[model samples]
Target: MKKEQQEKSFTMSGEKRSKVYEEEAAYLRNRRSVAGTHTTDRSGIAFSGGGIRSACFSLGILNWLERSGMWKEFDYVSSVSGGGYAVASVLEREFDGEGSGKTRAEMVVDKLRHDDGYLRSKSATLFLLVISASISGLLTFSPIMLLCGQSASLMINIYPRTVDNWASGIFCAASAVISLSTWRMPGMVGKLTLFIAVFFGSIQVAWVTGYLPPNLRVGMGILLILSWLIVLGLLGLGLSHPLIKRIQRASFLGLMANIVLTFAIVLHLVIDGTGKTHTNDVLACLYIVSLGLIFLALLASPNRLNPFLVTYYKSLQTAFGNGRDDAIWRNRAQQGDPIHLINCFVQSPRTREEPVRSRGGENFCISRFFCGSQSLDYFRTATWSSGREKKPVWRHQTIWRLITTSGAAVDVHPTRQSPIVNGLPTMFNIGLCSWVINPSFKRKHRKGGPVFVLNFAAAVGGNSIKQKWIRLSDGGHFENLGLYELVARQCMDIIVVDAGCDPEYRFSDLALAMEKCRDDFGAEIDIPGLFPQRSPGRCHQSKFEGYIRYRGVDKPAKLTYLKLVVTEHHSMRMRLQSSIDPKFPHEPTRNQFSTKAFVDAYYQLGCETAALAFPVTGTVKRAA
Candidate 1:
């Protein structure tokens, strides 16, 4: 018994041993990684915002996923606790030998001497990091989106655009160079320094020796990266580690190329002071600049680095089973369905320098895709108008409908009147519009073809300009033939396009229309509120004229409608622009269109003047 006990103790000690003592003197490898850099008090306020943002993002997404019924399969919430703890343990300063960073380093070292194996492993890790970053970036707007089945149109609409893709290429290239140069790779100091110096020094030498010029740097850089990629592939093949070999085969070179161009064009306008240039060029530059950085950041994230990206390369990874329907029937899943809506992504012709608008459209697109897709599965119904027609090219059946700004909901004219309308802008008085029809509702809602999903190309997020646009009503309604039977509508049969006075479509109007539609349509069950509530928390009221005054600072225009009326119970903060990024171009001066003050000038005067005749109810929640 004593001998056995000694043996067991020896084995246990071996199991617990990590490389903690190998090079404990080094601060980076010896100390710890900074993962939860936001939660610590030593962290900056910017970190605080990011931490709060991430938490809100996590909570919001999880809640939506559960509500959408996808939470059952994903198990993201429960798994998050374990995953978070594991990550914390590995990232903390005190944790010994469990870090993947260290393990990956050791693994690399094992094959370093074998050129072919080393090359392949390196390439594999790089490629994996690329895919992970792209996918992660894509998921930011649509976390619950499914990538396969009848709902693939959702993927199409959500995919990044040409310019954005180009930008990603630029961003990835820069990040790769930066990371490679700065990598605190686990190795002898002399060896590490030599590696970085050799690789980086080669580029510098190429430039100084006139082998590469500023104009041709991009081309030269590509060649440099390609050389690395080839070396990795050969190295990986020699080692026969399928994962690294897969990365070599997948080709990060091409993907990064696309992203690099995206970066060049996007940066042309952002920091180039080219807003006065052609719109196409300006737009192109803006996209590449923003998207490039984003992609680069993704490649740099450690969790996504090395050997994990082998998963997405399989285009045929049968994600979920489709019902026994023919391909023809299967593909037309999104046509004119209550749960499916066509969204557009607009961009100029490769180059432009223009002011980009991020707020209005992208918000509408994501909300519709995420919220609309979710409602169909748990709260609404989706029908394939194309399924009935039997063709991919016909009607509202396909997943993505690319309409232009001309298709924008605001232009359609209103033919009727709301008698109560007096001084209100004619835009809001309009009543019904198309796009709200529920044709599939009358028919037994057969489990709608695999959940039609929504995609938010980073374009649509609040970052800058959005190439992806999800069509929604602007100060209008689409109550056609009651909410039940969609009146046997045809794909292009013109669903009686009617408009009223409202020029802008706000949440307040949608909620009202939904409520009235309950009885007007005579449905068996009426959802109490598909829209959010309207109060200080849920609703915001602003006029175009009032907003114009918030922009100027010098002769800061006193907005006719923007004077605040603050009080005790309620403290309102209003500005021409969003309060989050309150500063405007003419902060100290006045552009007559720039923001000057951030005030609520109590609603007393505005409200008293306009009796609460058109009060809407709902909570105004910001998009996560």
Candidate 2:
């Protein structure tokens, strides 16, 4: 009976996966038909992420495509991070169905030119971020401090200062060190040491603080020692035993708890045992300030604030057009334009075990018809909600919100497990960006809202998929070039725009995408023209035609790669280099507050590079 039930469950899961694939295929077919490109051949253009620089560069490419009448040839536009900025703005304007008597690229460029400081200047938003951090610190740390204070007071009353207290403290510290060191080991030795450390240290603490009779303490200590020996004997068995694994995990957790409790008691005793009210008050204020600073450093650092400022600036009415932000997911794609795939990373919920793959998360795509990923399956975008009953839930998010979520370039990348290692630049503000929604069913009950504690816990815990809520951040955290999704869909002809920061032209983003594509989809991408001989005066080749041979597919698909680099032929490059900064196109991506000249220079560079790569007569060919 149990076997039959297990088989039934497996069959249901397989059916769900099939349904997701079919729905995605149907949506793509409809989009291709709308663009008049519903053929056996599939083509797509990918925009690489590099903040404002990439946005301007992609706009220029789009402008050239519009002028050359090649904009409608492709069926999909895949973008990540800043690359999504330009695409989202253009699509949102088109969805409004209001004619502006200008090309899509021109309208976006004009708006950006007028508001050149859109990415830099947001005093109000920055203030809000700081305030949010302060409040979060108070709410999160206050209870912890109060608990520590009560524990300290209880210890003072119950346990008088004795010589054994010092010994107990020493044992506690040693146990913490041993338990932390166990993270590096996976064998029985690590688990055995952890069990011994936790048990011995805990017994010492109880014996010293319990204030029992000497004979009773001696009896309890001997019993604990015997129990510890028995546990050590059991460790001789294989580590694969379920009971052993659980005990190992429990011992580690207990070790951490013991360390924290000891520190709190010591800190409270030192601060409040002064017996002078004035001194205690001063020390308490200092302690609170220290806590506030720690939270501020983690939550409201400049790196974290920059993404929020960029998102806020782009979401403004003046930036996109003077109209209400009424555009929804279903209307984001127009009839003649290609379907826009705004890629983001869905941070998985952490479990006890560490993740084997990308530590940051998986690739999540948001489009008009569907919103989800391959691992999580697909859901209808029209009726998607947060699913939590804590507050009023919206049926769908606006186009601007979706774009902001996609472009949220926080410091947490897919390679690292902790944000602290990256200087704690994780995005904790839930209002400005980062949307939480049900991954599978549209109406399933999901806990939602801006709970800072829960969000911070999720960020620290790393990414997994076994939780009630998923956090979405910058797609660049997984793949900056935005080509992975297109390759996953098996596009036959792909044009990639490489505008990321690459001063030496290393092509790291492209390399990352290549590695991931080969591993995930068994696709082999080869571009011989990427490496060219350098010339002093003339332009180095930035456009290369490659081919991708997908597994099980007979013929290789054509790939067009376009990169942004300085060339002596472009007049703007010479002019910008001479008058302004030497690094014209390769400026730091963090320079969101670029001057008007810088913005125009990048835009013109994009146009110049595209013109040189593919002349007016050039066209994107459909796959044979």
Candidate 3:
């Protein structure tokens, strides 16, 4: 029955997929005609991801393109990460048609210049996130810790305690250690250790409760054994069967039931208060502290809050004056602007059928009309925020949220199945920067309730994909260039703005994009001038022209690549190098609080680089 339901949900016919593609193509064509930019071939511009550095630099490129009347020629604009920041600003202005007689780029620069202390604002937001998580954990765990500690003290001081009871206690602790230590081991060893642990733990529970009244002792012991058996059975099914991963949640539910039962025992003992002593008090205090530490460790999962306080929302407020009030989606749908594709990655559990090009996840695209990926197929953007039950909820499917989700650049981790590298940041609550969203079709209820305790449990509790929630972070995690989607769309011409940090000019991001496009879409991208000799003393030429050939297309597409580098000498660049850090263009992306001069320097450098590459007369044909 369960398999049938899943099959029904994912029954995407080949005709349906083709229709989706055709519908999107027709929409793009209509949009181009409406904007008076229709051509025989489609064109797109891609902005690479690199936090604020990419945003400010892309703004400069847009300024020049708009001034030269070249921006309106494109049919699509694909942006990822920080590039989305600049694109969002442009869309905001275009939608509202209210820039106070200033160009969109100029207005954005002015707002950024006024609020130049970005670092301070970012730090305050991070501090607030940390403090709130800390307080929440303390308040949620204190009572449970006290109850468990008191119950343990009572069990230890039970009247007429025998050697068998003490032995059971020691054996239980030893088994628990062995169970936890060997949980990750493969083959029969892990299963055997777990079985031993559960067996001994159940016996210990029965033995420790022997001091209770005869009827109550028997009933509690029987209940504990049954709960353990049920949990163990569910675990066995989840591991042995491939189609019933959802049963994993049932196992957790069984474990939770056992916890509740244990809590009941603790509450009863604390109320009885027959084993009160100074030593017991000290032991309870120590247990509470230990539990507090555990809760703090679990607070690392930041699903409760969004971390775009300064980077995204503040930028929106600066650009539009009112961040959340603007109807970005509605405006774009009704206007003739290019189709905006905010590229993001959905972190999903890896399956054997998944293509190697997916890395560990799938490419999730958020556009004005549709939202989803190849794996999930497409869904209407208007109805996406409607909960799984199709009920209206607080809509999170907004353009600004999607843009921020695309630019979620910090605290990223691999999927749950992969071994976590550099997990310390996640443990320290730094992973809060990643955004969690509802899946397109399989959206589940927000796990847990309003209570912080239950919410914390849900956040850190299970690592099952059956939960049906989507984890989205920086597009850079999968592909930074934002070129994959354009290739997927099979655009005839593309201009890639490479603002990503590449001081060494290795072009790793570009290489990754090219490789994925070739492997996934059978699209070959070749740029002869992409590789140049590295020289520390001189600036490398930053513009290159290339061509791409798709698998089934008869005509190859033209590719123009623009990188953010100091290709030509500028007065602002010289001033910045002399006064501020020498690595003006190649500064670390962490320098979010750069001064107005810093912004102007990058902006000017961008304009000058674009001009030198593509002059007014258009004489330059390739990289110099």
Candidate 4:
């Protein structure tokens, strides 16, 4: 019995040992997951949006960091729009801490120098133009033709077979617009008032215009009345009490309206088609397809088709502008070229204070070479676009390369010897770089790499205050650029490179965006609350220097904002123009970047700047 007891004790002790080992292993696994591989040393680098110039500058900074043997310090890099291209370039090169024979900076520069033709290829431009034209045709120009035909059918009864189709199309569009516009109107009275007014107005107009047959007019009126009753009943229920609050909270009101409109239009078309000709059927089909395209164009993101024009016109009444063209007017009304904007600012030579005379009496200045720079005030109050001065609207920044001078471009400080119009850094394109980081926080639906293509315009919901779908423009639209992304990832250290267009080179954008991020995302980040604005004679030492300390509840990240402003002599534009068209004396030199020297210079500069930030390690070679 004593021998048996000894054997049993041994078995029990062995089992206990195994169990303890399993528990310890599980604990380590959980700890590993809770704190990522680099939890203690988590760091991120963000590049702000400044088109191609900012991108090139980011490459330069990356090169310098890599040379300093600190590239490995960064776990992830993020950027907005044009900055996205830079992040992509760096990721694609995948430069290990040590250069892979040729440094990524060198590769990037070399690629740009040799790949200029690809960017400016007729095929690429044609492709963009074709897409633009298709979008225009499907949404705008084509609809005009359809509307004209429908109008004629209503007034002159030319297409008797198609009268009902035209009337139904009109009703569908009107209903959708009304539903979307008034969906958020508080109180049942306001919503009901608008709905009744719109419904009655539409039916009366159709009757007066001969859009409805006299015999079916009564039936149509009764149908519309019943439809309105169902809608009103639903709205009443939605706003009544806590019981129906769940359904209201779901906010499927938009969907409900859409369903009702679709049903009503289809029913009318089907009933009217009982004795209609085949010609009518085809016309009806065409009308339906065209209407669908219109809705799709309006509702879809601008990435697929440039919808700036549509929104611009829609908001013209509220937009601030003189509604007049001027000499200093750049292509503010045209679509911005993200690539060219980047190239022009980073590479172009600074213009002299005196204007160069060009053909047709056009005074060529530096401001004429860039667009979308005038509207980049990080701290400026937001306002709708009205054709007037002092309004911070997106379209104002749309100015194309205007060669003429304007008050907007000039710094009116009395201390200046002359009004400095072109002195401002054009690449300081609002320091606007939108970033979507924190894979965990990304909308569950937006899986995959769609994160890269996301711009400021895509992330926001409809403006609840305006009761209009926010026409999301570029990442610059919101002004809350890249810094927030780093914070969201719980990065312990963040290095930011703001190569945007800033005349004073103040970190206003960085400060404002950070504060805004805190407000919007509950991000715990902090910057100088009373940071001084850019002023002359202040030594401006703060230009390339500033830091924002994270002051959140959780352990904060150390933030560093580096202003990477490239001078004219070192600019890629000047280098490109000198090599490509050095002989132009009588005309303004157009910007281009298709050479090796320019690439070498930019690459070297980037390396040098990064090296300055983190000097190379000699005794120990730290992995990036």
Question: Residue 186, candidate 2: how far off, in angstroms?
Answer: 14
Query: By TM-score, who's the top model here?
Result: 2
Better of 1 and 2 by lDDT: 2
Off by over 4 Å in 1: 1-392, 402-407, 416-476, 479-507, 522-578, 582-624
Give lDDT tens digits, candidate 3, residues 60-111.
Answer: 8877776666777787899998788887777676432653445567667777
The alpha-carbon lDDT assigned to residue 336 of candidate 2 equals 65
Q: Sort by lDDT, best first: what order?
A: 2, 3, 4, 1
Pitting candidate 1 against candidate 4, the one with the higher TM-score is: 4
How far residue 593's Cα lies from its native spot in candidate 2, in Å, is 0.6
Residue lDDT tens for model 1, 105-191: 122212222222101234655565566545444433222111111111111112324444344345545655665565565434543
lDDT of 1: 0.24
- Local distance difference test scores for all models: 0.24, 0.63, 0.62, 0.38
Rank by TM-score, descending?
2, 3, 4, 1
What value of lDDT does candidate 2 attain over all alpha carbons? 0.63
Which ranges of candidate 4 are over 4 A from the true structure?
Answer: 1-41, 94-100, 121-135, 140-474, 479-481, 521-556, 566-601, 617-624
Estimated TM-score per prediction? 0.18, 0.73, 0.71, 0.45
Worst 10 residues of 2 by lDDT: 8-17
Estimate the Cα RMSD of every predicted model relative to the unseen true structure. 30.3, 9.4, 9.6, 20.9
**Candidate 2 residue spans exceeding 4 A from truth:** 1-38, 95-101, 122-127, 140-150, 158-318, 326-328, 349-358, 387-392, 417-419, 426-435, 441-444, 532-539, 572-579, 618-624
